[model samples]
Target: MPFEHYKEVDLSSRNTLGLPSVSQYLGAFHSVSDLQHAFEFARNLSLPCFVMGGGSNILLPEYLPGLALLSSDRSIDIMGDEVTVGAGASWDNLVAETLKNGLFGLENLSSIPGTAGAAPIQNIGAYGVELARFVVSVEALDLQNGLAVTLTVDDCQFEYRDSLFKRHPERFVVTRLTLKLSTRFAPILAYQDLQRLPAQITESAEGLRRAIQSIRAKKLPDYRVFGNVGSFFKNPTLMKSVIQTLEQAQVLNSNTRSAQGKVSAAALIQAAELGDLSVGQAGISPKHHLVLENRGGATLTDVLTLAHLIQEKVERRFGVTLEIEPQQLTQLIHAPNPKG
Candidate 1:
């Protein structure tokens, strides 16, 4: 069956930042067949395909004149300690479901937004746990050749906030994720926030999940209220010599370190005193320096302006460049041709 496609789809409500945007064409990939059908449509029209996840980690432009795809293959199957989930499956839902079924590893990543397929791309980590540690393999379609292939953890080349998929956005689409979880509850409470929790909160798998969720709730803005994409910048990881250089320059603290002993991006922004900075409706989140909030009625330019300001100020002060965590539409996909 041919895939059904739509045109001029409104995407303002699709992204977490609530930027007003529109896609020239839109479709869903229910299965591999659907994927081929959608690509055929785009191929015939000479339009590039852009995949949209839960809309949690993307920045959309005002108009996208190509095909915008959303994965709808929300399939989940559990066999022993291995769990397989479709690309469209909600990440939080997967975490909750696995925990309910006695799987214990994803408890630390409790409330992360976006889909399961998007998890491996970023090697999403939180509370001392990384998705790469649990990922058995990633079932993806190599768009460059239109073939399905399963990528091993090594093939993924997992790094802090980056992976092969992330590096080459147009090459592959994650169709499914296979994770090897554990029945035994091994709680990881090494993060600074988790460290503050009492013993009871960290005693059980569920307890740790709820505690982490609560902590995130207090720090992160409700997208419904103030649109945001969690942390907007990745923490900067540097070599020991770089750290010493920064410390000597007074741009970094000798003690304030983040995961993998990297300097915290949030700390750098806070030290730059960018909390009160804003461009129109876009502002630096006072609650968390790493988050850039879209106060309703904000445009993409507003957000970009504010982000640029933060980057400029932080870099001016710390001599460290803060990399944007979320993928921008322009960066992720080929520019859509208005002529088409």
Candidate 2:
């Protein structure tokens, strides 16, 4: 297929936030050959390419000046307990497929909204289980070399909601992901909500899947009905000394636990009584302090404004800075160092 056939596509449906935007150029690649051809087209035009998967984690501005590559291929293969999925494969689909095959490692990540290829970008995690634990390798198209390559888990540099893909956004476009899962029936019941689930001998992959879905349904707003990109900000990790100072001053909640002396950002936000704070169409979800939601027809500017306000309020109250989890498209507008 000619690359021109997929150029300048509207990206409203592609992104989860449903933000209306138009890419200067857009290309869809289903196979490795298609990806190579797309890259060639991009090179000829001298336009930077932005790779997008399910578009669950991004907030696109009203207008994008570069090419957007939408990965549409969705294929999966199972080798015993190991699963290899196409980059365009939905992450929630992988979780469901694993459970059907009696694999248990990904049950905790059920209902996450993104593609398998994007999981390692943020080391997508939930309920104490992270994608890094099961990732075997990642296949990506190296933009600089004009070839495809495979990266091991170590090469990805997995961290709390960060990885090599996120650190260097322009270097590679993920094409495929291989994950190592377990056929055994060991369920991870470590998170608070999971521990509260009723005990059952059938606590296998399927059981854990059901429990995770239930917990997410109760905690997170449905993206289909309500516009949201999951948790807006990451739970800030503070130094031990700073946590102690806040604890002594009664700024940190009593229920907050120490992560080697670091306090939870959720606890701190709730302690500061900013749980239901709102600014125009944006507000912090009263149900969960970590989530910032767009009530309706909210623009990217509104979201960023509320986020900055929340960060400033938190920092002024506790002297700890909060980092946003989702990728921001308009960081240039807020040029001041957020740490300030």
Candidate 3:
């Protein structure tokens, strides 16, 4: 084996929500050689395998039930406006580094809590900026054959808030990310909140990042402080006519449009009057309705129940379904909850 493996590894602290989870087998791999060896080890045991990144966007099961792969490489290389980042490297830190290196374009994505691997996996976006815009190529391994592959940006098939990597999690494990950034500063202040920034702040990259970070600080609770996924439900994007009907019914407000044809998920959740609601120890975040928090010692069951209740209420009120944003480890997609 290219690297040693551990059994029954504790994963509570590995995830942002601090859920108590354990993996049947865990291996830290530095290169493709190590990844292949780990996969072979899992194959010998007839178990499944998955790439585990910063764990910020996943709801882990109590037990992972298979091989949990961890990327140990954390290198970041910069040449002019191009950068090559190890998958395990911090996404926020990468943004910061690029800004310090005199590169622009990632300022609006400041403070997103996840690793580089998770960025493309989620096609992370904030304040009108999506990670897909800067991605040139992604280096990954085809898990089935353990073959190294570099996928062009088009091969990624990035969408509103999704990517092929997310849809085909079982097929690939991201190893590195290559981005082509810009030397010129072209700030994207299209989002309403960003447009409110003082002209002086918009003139500099760090100032723009500070403004975005400040807005996030007010909207989301720090995961370290209160165990939670930043955004629990993705905004329901529909045809403008569909949302207009909901608006006529007094379900969503005209100001709630975050993007064209996308009504705010937080608005829908609030319309259900669920901001003050809680199920057991899991509660809808009072600060932002889209955030679900573990008040204290909350189980996955508690969170799911609370989320289901919100979904049902919103669906009944507006005839629109709310989709959970964080990936579910137990079931990738939500199945209908009969009781709801």
Candidate 4:
């Protein structure tokens, strides 16, 4: 299809967080050629461009000033145990498809929202399995020259909830991803809840995926039901010495402490007594302390206000600064950063 651009597009329902926004110019691209053309269009107009996928990991302002591009290329190809997926492909669908084909590497990552391109950007993790472990390479468009390039896993610089794409948001527009899956059943049950699963469940790929889906369903609010972008804060991984100091001071609760010296951000927020905390219509999710929710008709400012309050309280109570997890359109918006 020819490249099409629209003006004054409403994006309230586009984002999982449900923040209302109106883009100055918006384009949806279905192929690599269309993607490059969109970038060129933005450049020719001297307008700043923002590329979005799935709209699951971003907070948009009331009115965006430039071009907004959405990836709509949803396609997947499986070669033996290796799967090369389009950036716009649903992440959960990829997991489901792989498992149905007897693949095992993605079971622990089941039920995650967003697209394949976003997976490596955030190094998305759950139930102890991270996307970084299975990624072979990422294909992206370098907007500088409107050229397509392939990036190796090492080149992506994956870290805890961060990557090279995140650090340099303007440089790469992820178009496709190639992941190396496995036919062998190798389950990772290191996370606390996953460890509690029965041997019958843990022994199989589909069984483990179901167990994780059940666990997440109980702990996290579905974006469809409640306006949210999943976890709002990254779990803080600290030095053992720092954890010991907090423990001695009786500041770190038992539930927050992990064997690897990481503390749950949710536990810290709860410790600060910020559960059910709200600003305007934005509030913390009662189901999971880590999530910030929009009760209804919430603004971007309201969400930021609530997030600031949480950070202030957690820092005051535990002396740890909580970092935000999602990418945002505004300057004040907190993009995912390394855990403190």
Candidate 5:
């Protein structure tokens, strides 16, 4: 049995929001054995447990109630063209490693922040490629039974920016992920920015990676210096009838229906003139309408207020609701109210 260590841990360093707080107890697990021991210890002590990966998508309040278990074991093994990575392994690192090995599918996802375990949590996607397309299986520890289980791709129940793990957070602690990648160069350049590259060039994976990185660098704020999560909101998808109503009202800037008939959320937000809206210290990113940034010393309350205001204004103007992407701290004063 692996021994578990617990202590009062500061969350400011663990979460990307950088909110100052202390978890009641915190521990790190390197292997399945370690995760099992930690789970048992939390159960014996009757404390709720929270699992964390790279901590990119969470907001912590001043005091968190339970133990936070961080996955810190970073290991990767490549067999033929299949790659197996520890949950704690950095997501970008895995992409880079795959590219170095001549694998092609992950190039479009380069530079995204977070760990491999968290990738499947949201089926992390960018520049036209998503993690779900390549994922073979995920290894997780069942917290309730203290048993390790391997989940196939279908078991993950992937959707746009969501997965079964998110819907059932308490059921499993992800330990590792396995992906199948291609050896030959095949690229997807359907995104507008990547489309600028000559068709012949984008036909190769290396060229696609360069194009994706270049586009992202120009569109997204550099996270190293700026304390901002990628996109603050998921583009609100709208039904065809809703789109027609908005169009008839002359309330839309531009509308593009997905093959599945959903309207684009970004287009709706831009049409609402919320691209440059600001509240207190938080504001919609001037560069991208869907992003909200905390301009120094901004509190979670400030961000939430701005988000609520945006939602309110959009609903008032076009009758559509905007959904936030990140998980907010439950105790924050501006936390979203329950829907009736």
Candidate 6:
């Protein structure tokens, strides 16, 4: 099959942040064949390629020098409690559909942007659940030899906001994911916010989903209104000793613990007086300090500058380094159309 390829592509609106980017070559792959073909096309030219889905958790450079492959397949198959979803399927749609079918485990993850394929890469989580808990397996193409491989949950090596795929990004391109959900309702009320859920809405899947959705809507800035890529920094995790030091110094608030040894990044940033901070058109969201917004005409440089400023302030004030959550790309080869 001949793969469709385009050149000089404008991706200003592709990313949730609405940053302007131009690719020299862009390939839209709709099937396994198309995906492989596009990769081979880039390989032939010895150009670096970057695979993207839904354009959510990424920071792209102003110019991509090589191929930008987009996974656009959207297929979902359900069998009992097991679901096999295409990488390109809408993540929110998956959450909504699973609840509609009486599946339980995904309700807490509702309303996250990006495609199904991108979830496990960051071990995407929210409210009190992580995608790793439901992922049965992942199918990926080994870009090294153009072969396919399946990785079980244990092989994923999921840790706070990270996975093996994120660690070895150049080695594999994910194709699909299989998730094992539950037929019974079991809401996780461990999160402080969820613990406050009204009694009337705590028993059913739909109700829990709606409640989580409402909370996210109220707290997070709508990317449409003020462009952003959700949480801009990973919640900085500290060792027990380090946390104790910060606590003694009174740099963190009393209600900052998230897990046995972790604290909330937002709280630290807020404590450091980094909220509502700005650098050019990029500014920290006033509603949520962890979100960096594209106020308008924000450039990649502006975003990075603001991010650095935040990092410096948070670190100087709290002695903990703030790590960026989104993946950053200096450049990915997107070659020009040969026939053009």
Runs of candidate 4 with Cα error greater than 4 angstroms are 253-255, 331-340
- lDDT by residue (102-146, candidate 6, tens digit) is 888999999999999888889999987999999889998776666
List runs of model 5 lying over 4 Å from the truth.
Answer: 1-6, 248-257, 329-340
| TM-score, cand. 2 | 0.91
Q: Which pairs of residues collide in model 2?
A: none
Tell me the deviation in Å of residue 321 in model 2.
Answer: 0.7
- Measured with C-alpha atoms, the lDDT of residue 65 in candidate 1 is 78
Q: Give the clashing pairs for model 5.
A: none
Tens-digit lDDT track of model 2 for 1-340: 5675355678777777666778787777776678777766666666556777776788878887666776777888999878999888989998888778777788888999988888988999998889999989999877666667899999999998999889878677788899999877777786767777777723567777887888799888776766678877787777777877887888775457546554567777887789877877877877677777767777778778888888898899888788888885432111111111
lDDT of 1 by residue, 1-340 (tens): 6779899999988898999999999999977668877787787788888888988888899998789988898888999999999999999999999999998899999999989988988899987789999988999877767778899989999998899999989788889989999999988887878888999888899899999989999988888789998889998887877777766767677456753568888878877777899999999887888999998889989998888888888778767888989999777773322322
Against the true structure, what is each candidate's TM-score?
0.94, 0.91, 0.95, 0.93, 0.89, 0.94
At residue 27, give the lDDT of candidate 5.
Answer: 83
Give the 10-residue window scoring lowest on summed lDDT in candidate 4.
Answer: 331-340
Best by lDDT: 1
- The C-alpha RMSD in Å for every predicted model, in order, reads 2.9, 5.0, 5.0, 4.3, 4.8, 3.1
For model 4 the local lDDT of residue 225 reads 81
Q: How many collisions per candidate?
A: 0, 0, 0, 0, 0, 8
Instruction: Name model 1 segments beyond 4 Å from true.
Output: 241-255, 334-340
Whose TM-score is higher: candidate 2's or candidate 5's?
Answer: 2
- Output the better candidate (4/5) by lDDT: 4
The reply for model 2, stretches above 4 Å from the true place, is: 253-255, 329-340
